[model samples]
Target: MMTISSSTFLMAVVACLLSPAVQALGVLPHTATRTPSSSSSSLFMVGRASADADFAKAPLTQDDQAVDPNVYNVNDLELAAQLWQVSLSSKTNQPNRPANTPFLDTKPFLPKDPTTKYVVDNVVVQVSRTGGLGMQLWELAGGRDDGCGITLIEGVSGNAEAAGVLPGDSLARIQYTTSMQGTQSSTTATEMDVAQAITTLNCECRDFDATMEVLTSLPPPEVVDTLTLTLKRLRTWPQIDVVVE
Candidate 1:
């Protein structure tokens, strides 16, 4: 130490001063033989790797992000309702409605062919006096003094109604019998005889049971015993099948 050079003496003095300063700061000296553990180095590497993985897994586009349905506010729903009401008001105010409007379909539906043919066959209806056949008869008039035939007034409901008789039906034929004073007689009537047939029905055939035999003897003073009618509907305008139920 007595023979040290100037440069060497200065270096030793600096090292002595830095050693106490390092001890005061609690810092490890450079001459200490310490190495970081493998576990600590691996933990630091794993943290960096996890951060990179999370960034890679993020959605690339706005469309790819998941949207929550409940995120819409009340204001958004009110706007939608207002827009619908405006559309409905516009449709209502228009003079000519759009084809898509629902009101046009409410009209009565009729078949495409109005003049289709239909036949009602062998409709036998029993007539009694008490339960008068629920119908109003109108004598058809055109170009002739005597009535052409009797037509049914539409919308009358009765026993004939159940037999599918409609308004404007022509009475074609009728057959009945009358019993008076131990005598029985049968008579068939056509359109020409409708007036006489009606007279007989009102006067002689009043209030008889539907199931009673025409030829059977009734109590005194009753002229006509029983009655049955045949109705016919020709296919023309207002095409519909007159069905008996």
Candidate 2:
């Protein structure tokens, strides 16, 4: 009879337990090894057996390629990573769409003819201390009394009458030139009060003459040489013929 040492018997038993045929017989493997200093042959056998089982269970493709259960191909992994990065970037960098808005019309409406037409002309007048313009002015009834229009009370002979300004004439605009501090400036007034018009004309005449005095070294008389006024007169009149039988 051959005598087997206890350690050798133990190593053989471990090898049998780690074998797949022994595992099919329902036996659990031991943790111990043979020589107490050798590599774990039982553990290596168990690992190899488990790897073989996994490879057997993995499904094969139509091309007969042995698909790995745990390993990933480097090219496939890189392509998947690139696709994921592209999808994320497209979502993050998308532009906002403009909202639907309605359009608006902004053209202005204009009239063909004006309600009133003005006769523009320049008139020269001499100013007096007692009565400036030497004309009478009246506020018209049913007129634009917001200082935009005025009626002349004429027929009295003075500087205004000499300037051909007639009675019932309507004045709508006035313009004049004035000088102050050696600077000449033009002023225009579309709306003015009777008192304000008198003051403006007087000031303009005084300032202009004073400026001329400084430039020519000779004093000019206090008179407005040119005053622009917009006058409105009736364009049509009613006529009646008289018949004597």
Candidate 3:
């Protein structure tokens, strides 16, 4: 069984956001992979717009252009919803939250160079007579490593997620072409013949000034997409609350 300790994997989820599709999907972990319903799409746009507004002032490079202000079509919104997988884990194991627990606070152990700000809303903290309420949506993944037969955390419903995804559903591959992975590709030049031809780009230079262009199939004309989301702190269990019955 795959156990999800929220604190341990939150960084991995954040790391997954580096993918261009994840940014387009407007969530951290799961990249968007479908067309969204119209209402869901509108809500996604609201959240996406909010995210863009928040990031607008950051010193980012041209690669960040994927998030520029734009209304997403159905596929974009669907992918956004799929990518927002945090809430599913939340529903399975919300702790016995104190009646007076502060909604937000800073963690000393987390990276402090540029403090990550967290905001929690519309979260349903689960209450158990024995276990109390645990923070919801710890993590999500498929049972198989090959990305098939995926299972959601138990006793969770992805539909209740503000991001508009269903729980326990297996995610298919992102409907994208991998045409950019060859030797002739300007980006990620995976050359088989020449060793010196492929030099990894500098980290700082790759961060602020990189703009890669790729040609891929668009979502079907009938599909419309958008993204809707909310967020919360990356949580860890206090020593006093770690025991499970």
Q: Summing lDDT over every window of 10 consecutive residues in candidate 1, give the lowest-scoring window.
A: 9-18
lDDT of 1 at 98: 50
Candidate that beats the other on lDDT, 2 or 3, i.e. the better one: 2
Identify the leading candidate in terms of TM-score.
Answer: 1
- TM-score order of candidates, top first: 1, 2, 3
Tens digits of lDDT, candidate 2, 68-127: 211111112112112111001223332321233111111111144333221212222222
User: What TM-score fits each model?
Assistant: 0.29, 0.25, 0.16
lDDT of 2 at 183: 26
Q: Could you tell me the TM-score of candidate 2?
A: 0.25
lDDT, residue 191, model 1:
19
Encode model 3's per-residue lDDT on 36-131: one tens digit a residue. Answer: 222122111222234558666544333332321112211232222243332222233336333432222223333442232222222112111121
Candidates 1 and 2: which is better by TM-score?
1
Tens-place lDDT digits, model 1, residues 1-245: 12221111000000000011212212211222222111000011112234558666543333333322112111121121121110122355545445333221101222553333222222334544333344443322222332221222233344444444444333444455642232233453321222233422211111112111211222222444344555433221222244455
Stretches of candidate 2 off by over 4 Å are: 1-131, 142-150, 180-226, 237-245
